[model samples]
Target: MKLYYTPKSHFARKNRILIDALSLEVELVDAGNVADSTPEIFANNPLMKVPTLVDGHQVIYESDHIAAYLVRKFDPTDSYQVLTNDVNQLNLRAVMNGVMTAEVELIMAERSGINTQHLKRFDKLRATVTQGMNWLENQADLFPQQPSYAGFHLICLWDHLLLYQMFQLKHPHLQQHIEKLSGFDCVVKSTPL
Candidate 1:
């Protein structure tokens, strides 16, 4: 199996961490996203996105789906049950994903200098992230005791936000939670370079 990804992409980092945690041997193809559409990536993923997995004839994209596949296929411990069986963690994961999407959009808009007309939207997006962080802070106790898929996504979310300096969320509890998550080996090994 091979994964087409960029080393710095948090989405790709999620998969890389999972692969390492599972101790699965897979080739990491450094397919940088330099163009609007790279023909090589488009051939495998119509979306021309990173973290595209090629497992024989099967092609998988999207970080969450790829994580699920890894859990079902590679994890003998079934640790993914912590993410799938818990309702609160699932909702927390969804919030993390929402923040991630909004942060990416904000980053793209700022990078492209398209900030004039969408100023309010950008502010709203920032506010949305803050709200999500607040929610996570309040519900930190409900987090899984072990490093599961949801915990991985949460760590990725916090790292991505900090990496781009997009927005700072000032919640001490969440910060502690993040620190705790970062202590995991998968997270330590998956830090974006």
Candidate 2:
């Protein structure tokens, strides 16, 4: 098995979280250094994506998809272990996904420090991020119940957000969000990307 990954990517980190949690073994290949023009990833995924997993003849792409696949393939009992099986799971996953992408864009913009070209994109993403956070705040009940794929990804995203300092997330709702995650401390603390 092979995993195409980039060290600094939250998406890649998500997969690593699952791999570690399930004690899965796979070869990790650096595949996102576009400066070197990684046509192999584009060829494998057709979209030039990272965190693509190749399990023998099967090629699984997308970080979330790969995470689910890993859990199912390696640890069938993993579903309720890190995530809940609620109907609202996808919505929670959406919130986490939004935060992850927003954090990624924000961090990249800060590091690049570009002018009109990059700042404009940052402005748009920032607005979208606020909307996503509002949604998550409104759906705060999504956590604290049971574990689900959404919950797992949400914690993964939250950890990455904290690690990268995406925003001064010490806001009230942010603290509430952390409190909501108290139930899954075992899985969250156990998995290290």
Best by lDDT: 1
lDDT of 2 by residue, 1-193 (tens): 8888776666776676567556678788878563335558633676676778888999988887887777777776775444345567666776678777776767665666754244667777777666776677677665655544455566666666667654555445544655565355444543345
Best by TM-score: 1
Indicate the residue-level lDDT of 156 in model 1. 84
Q: TM-scores, in order shown?
A: 0.89, 0.72
Tens-digit lDDT string for candidate 1 (1-193): 9988877777888888888878889888888653457658633587777778888988888888888877778875776453375678778878888888788778777777786344788888888888888888898777766776766777788888888886776778767767877877778987976
Extract clashing residue pairs from model 2.
83-147, 83-148, 84-147, 84-148
Clashing pairs in 1: none
lDDT of 2: 0.65
Residue 108 lDDT in candidate 2:
60
How far is 189's C-alpha from truth in model 1 (Å)? Answer: 1.7
